[model samples]
Each structure stands twice: as C-alpha cells, then as structure tokens.
Target: MSKDSSQSFLLSDSAMQAASYSTYQNFQSSPTLCASELQNWKQRIGLFQTHLQTTATPTQGSLFDTTSTQTSLDSIKPFELRRQNTEFWRWQFDDVGVPAMYFVIDYIATAQKGPILLYIGETVKSNQRWKGVHDCKRYLTNYQQAHRDTGLKSELAIAFWPQAPADRPARQKLESQLIYKWRSPFNKENWRYWNTPFITGKEP
Candidate 1:
C-alpha cells in the first residue's frame, strides 16, 4: 500500500481494537452488575418477609385486647396554681368534684432542676387541701420560715391532675407513680422509698 493508505489502515485497525477491548470489558463487568442487582433484590425480599412476620404476629397488651378503655399518660390533663393563691382554694371547691393527684412544687428549686416535686398526694374529694394540716403542710411551713429568716427564695406552687369523679383509684395510682418518680421530700409514703435527703434551704 502507498504510505498515506498504510497509515489510514493502521489507524482504522487501532480504533477497531479499542472498540473490541471496550466491548470485552463491558461483557466482563455484566456478571458483577447482575450479581449486585440480585443481592439488592434478595435484601428487599428479606425485608419484605420480616415485615410480613411482624404484621402477622400478635402483640400483647394491644388496645383491642381489653373491652374497657385504657387510660394513657397523654389522657391525663395537668393544671398548675401558686399554693398561696386564692385560685388554689377556689379550685378545691370546683362544683364538678373530681378526684385529683396534687403536687407541692418549689418553683425556685425548679429553676435548678425541672419542677421540684416537694410532695405528692391524691384526694377523692376535690375540696381537700393536703387533708387539713398534714406533715406536708408542716414541711412547707418550716421551709417558709427558713425562707423568711435567710431571705431564701420560696415560690411554692401546686399542680393538679383531675380525673373523672369515679377514677379515684387511678388518681391514687398516678400519685404513687409521681411520688416514686420524683422522690418528693414531704411525702410520708416516699420517705422510706427514695431515702434521699430533702433539697431545702435549711441543712437537715
């Protein structure tokens, strides 16, 4: 062949070889791509099987298991009042007379911790205020005295969780749970339970 024709033929051959090598590489990689796709499909199937098994299994304590309505924490409504306020007294005399769980909170202590649950109690009668001069009240009185003497910040507050008039037992149970959770200082029942010292302005 002439010199130019020979160069053109060599270029065409090189291009053909490159195209063949590219096709060979793609062919070699095809199995790996198929394997990866198959693995992904297997994982998806496994997940689908797990989901089916979970859906088919019966869960204990499901809402539908009981004929009676179950009360959840979300169902409990909370109300707050300053212990010294007239509104606190008025709330006791509310005409509905619902059972309630009450919490004596030190709002000042709450500034350090979350709401300092000083004491917890429940009453069947809405009108009852710590059952007319209880140990809880005495504790509060002593704390107030310390506040006056030492100029300690004392912002005592009360919170109530009123439930249906007939749900006194539930209210009491909730009160016990709150006392256990908060380890309230003045609660006689929790005195032996938490065994933790009271966080008060006074040492003892």
Candidate 2:
C-alpha cells in the first residue's frame, strides 16, 4: 500500500546552466518579437510541457474518478516519492508482496432501483513490470455465467498493477474472501450488497 522508496535528484550547476541556456536560445531566432513577449512565451510553453510529461501516476494516489484538469493537477504534488526515474517508475509493479489483481469501484448509484457498480482491476506480476488489466470483461463473463441474474456488469477504469511475489495463490484467496465478506455492491442481488453507504474524500 506504500511506495518502496523515495529519492530526489538535484541537477548539477553546469547542467542547470546548460538547460537555461538552451531555453533562452530556443527563442533567440525570433527577431520579430519583443524580448519580454519572447520570455513570457517560453515560460508558458515550458510549464505546459512539464505538465504533460509529469502526470500523477496511480502510485501517488487514485484519480478519484474525476477528470484531469489544472486545478486537480495542482492539488497533487509536482514531485512524488515513487517517481524516482521516469522509466524506472513507469509501470513499476510490486513483485514480492501481493502478486494478484485488485479492484476499486468508481461509483455506486444506490438511488436507482438497480444501481450499478463500476469496478476497475489491476494485475501485478514479478520483475516489477506493471501492466493494465484486460480481463475485466472476461471476469464479468464468468460471474454472469455463475449467476444469471446477479446483474453485475463490467465498467472498467484506468488499470495498473503492483509488485508482488510469484506465490500469489494467497492473494487470490484473500481477494475472494474479501469480496464474499463485503458482499461488494458488485453482486447486487446479495442482501449485503450496498447495505451501507460508502464515502470517499480528497486525501492530501
């Protein structure tokens, strides 16, 4: 549930100077523009590119089922403990712990006569190589076959896995037990499904 480590990298003085020089020189050829305007444009472009390159990955926190925007993004930290190196953190799975899939339900509309639950899944394998879960539809197929009128349908969200051990049978069993014990709203027909309200808040 937590990150493996946190390490911050500070750019060397020479490297910083070089980067500043490159940014300034990029606008040097614009003879038709005023100096102030050129500097402002460069600053804005730099900020925009930074935004695109650095997104808040799932490791930092969940998206909370909201659309990404300047405000939401600003609410998140620019630098995270998990983002050590771009390539290293990207799709880095947890291999020694829970080597299995996990789900987060996006929404549960209890107001309706037949409310729906949005379930998202993640698959964790060894080698710390993380990938999105694609078997949500397949899992729904199996669930539907077992119970024709359970009314559980698949509504997949952004997927990613954690690092976990190869001996994952325990994880699968735990998931099954949790699902049964909680009687997740996923199984609407069950009396335990949606019996209580679920609350989520924006965590800092």
Candidate 3:
C-alpha cells in the first residue's frame, strides 16, 4: 500500500477504537446513549424505525444525484475528506475549529449506497458549529440509530475542505450547490427524498 493508504488505514483503525471505547463506556453508563452523543436512541429512533418499516414500498421521487456532485480543482470529493488533519473531530475533540466547508458522512459502504453522505454544510466556525444549538446533531442521532436498529454498520464522521471560499456568501453558495447535488439525506432540503423520519410531523 502507498503512504496515504497506510495513513488512512491507521486513521480508520483509530476511529474504530475510539468508537468502540466510547460505546463500551456508554453501555456501562446507559444502554442506549453515549456521553459523546447528544440524544438517546429511544428519543430519536421511533420515527426512523417507522420510516424503515415502509422503505420497501415504492416511492415516487428521485434522490439528489451524488454521482454528479462537483468541486473546484483545489477541492476533493466530499467522501475524500478525512477526520482531523483536515476534518477535526466533530464528535469528541477540542472545540477550536477553522472556517471550512464540512461534510457529515457514513464511512461504511453497502452495495446499495456506497458511503452515505448524510449532510453537507459550510461554516466559518466549523468546530464551534456543533458547540451551539444545531438541529443537524439530532438528525444525526436518528440516522445512526436507524442504522443500528437494522444491523448496518455506520462510521459517522465529519470532514472539511481547506479550499472553501473565504467569503461567507460565496462559501454558502458552494455549500448550497453541494447540498443540492448530493441531496444528503439528513439535510432538510433533501429530507423528503429519503423519508427522513426526524422532521417534525411531516415524514420528510
């Protein structure tokens, strides 16, 4: 394997170790929720579980075309972004973060979906974004529980783009474009396409 591949393997292993250790701690304290996690599965799982029940039924709408998502030459694919070095820990780490275009991703790939891009966002305060009130955090809770309930593996991590435009308006415009392009399920704009269960009373 190449140098980059070796580093990636080490990173992936460390993330797994962190998650395993956290999960063990959570299980020791509370069966359903971890200290790092904001909400309990019971609180968020109900809606997602119900939605999963009917996923077999045919749906009419189309998901955003992730295959067509693009980035400037200086940028990489959303899935290509890694934790810390570029991504910094969105879950368990120091809150000091940088201005970046960020992605919330499920690293585990299934034959059906490959790696799941749950949300795409841009933030001047990438690390501090979750430090304040953020709805996306709750959505992520549900999304993870949805996977767990179905025995699906999910390696949820946040990543960043160092090349994001410095201007807030320009950065936000790029964020909007990518969000629409990927139609990431947790993002409100594409929630309808995925039958996102966490949306209030709407089944988006």
Candidate 4:
C-alpha cells in the first residue's frame, strides 16, 4: 500500500481497538500495540494536541474574542436624561441633531412622593417637539381638569434624553423599556389608568 494509505489503516485500527475497550479500566488493562503502531498513535495524538492548541488560542481581531466583544460593548453610550422642563412648549427650538425620547411626569404634592411618570414618547427630530404637542396638550389639559375636580395638587413636566440621530429603533426600544419599568398610566400599552379623563371619553 502507498505510505498515506498505510498510515490511515494504522490510525483506523488503533481507533477500533480503543473503542473495543469501552470502559476506562478495560482500556487501561488492554494489551499494548506493536512498537511501530504505538509510535504512530503517539504521533497522531501529538498532532491533535497541536491542532487543539492552535484553535484555542484566539487570533487578534477575531469577532468572538473578548477584546473585540468588549470594544463593541464600549461603543454604545449610556442613555441619559439631558433636559427637563415643566413648560416644554415654551422651550426654544434648537436642532439637537439627534432623536430623543421624552417623559411626561406629574409632581403630585398630595401623594407626598416623587414625580410620577404619566407618559413616554419618542421623536425622530429633536427640534420638532411641536409635532408631539397635540397629544401632550390634550393629556395635560385632561389631567389638570381631573386634578382640579378632585382637588389634587399636581404639576406636569417633561424630561428628555437625546440619542444618536440614526438610531430610531434604539430610541423606540428605550421608550418601551422605560414605559414598562415605570408603568406609566397614560401610555396606551401600560394602560393602568386608561379610564382617566380624555382617554376614556370623560373629557373635562
């Protein structure tokens, strides 16, 4: 037989013998192979070890490596609330050059606790805050009327977080997470207080 074919037959025979001795005790008690076959087996084992070592050592810039993974994570900036205002409408328009998510909060004095999140929303154009005013104005008016009728001391304010301009999906994801975390009453999906005025046709 050719040299390569002879080597393959020797390796296959060694593997079959190893498999036949199923248990660890059986494998240890099995008779040793001839010197030539034993040398071939040792050489194959050394080659496998070298292959395993090469594969286990990560090459630089590998996508699955720790350094590359950490660099990807570091690229993402944390979301932070940049501006807050009680009269968001009165705030002058400035092109922030980023998409933004905003929160409508109510400072309820009667509750004697911190501000309560009323609604969460996002906008692709940060300067075009007016585009969202219709819903904000309506909710605020209804909230004020309802509070007035019940004699609860409350004031509305908006908080904003500007995010990188191209990430509209990220902004929306953040909005959903915040809505779920705060359980905002006016958010339609988290409609805990959907029966509140202006939402349930109880406009004041």
Going through the candidates in order, what is the number of backbone clashes in each?
A: 0, 7, 2, 0
Model 2, residue 38: C-alpha shift (Å): 55
In what order do the candidates fall by TM-score, top score first?
3, 4, 1, 2
Candidate 3 C-alpha lDDT tens digits along 1-204: 244322322224465455442121111111243422422322233244234334432222343233332315213476666653212333553344455787876665343334556678887755456554456656655555655655656666767665566689778766776666555667888766665555332112
lDDT for each candidate structure: 0.43, 0.30, 0.51, 0.45
TM-score of 2: 0.27
lDDT of 1 by residue, 1-204 (tens): 244322221113333334331110111111112334433332443343234333422223432234332234324323243233312442223243346566676555422232355677777654555433344544565545444444445566566555433466656655655554444657776555543223222222
Query: lDDT per residue, candidate 2, 1-204, as tens digits?
Result: 445421012223443334332111111111233434423432443343244345532322332334533243234222221211112212323333334333333222221221222232223432232223222333333322322233433222222234322345644433343333323343333224333111211112
Estimate the TM-score of every prediction. Answer: 0.49, 0.27, 0.58, 0.50
Residue 167's lDDT within candidate 3 is: 86
Best by lDDT: 3
Model 1 ranges off by over 4 Å: 1-87, 90-96, 192-204
User: What's the lDDT of the predicted structure labeled candidate 1?
Assistant: 0.43
Candidate number achieving the greatest TM-score relative to the actual structure: 3
lDDT of 1 at 26: 11
The segments of candidate 3 whose C-alpha lies over 4 angstroms from its true place after superposition are 1-75, 84-95, 200-204
Give the per-residue lDDT digits (tens) of candidate 4, residues 1-204. Answer: 244322221113333334332111111111323444433332343343234333432333432336644343233222223324434333343333246566666544223233455677777654456443255455555555554554455655565554423477655655665554444556777554233333433212
| Residue 59 in candidate 3, Cα distance off native in Å | 25
Clashes in candidate 1: how many? 0
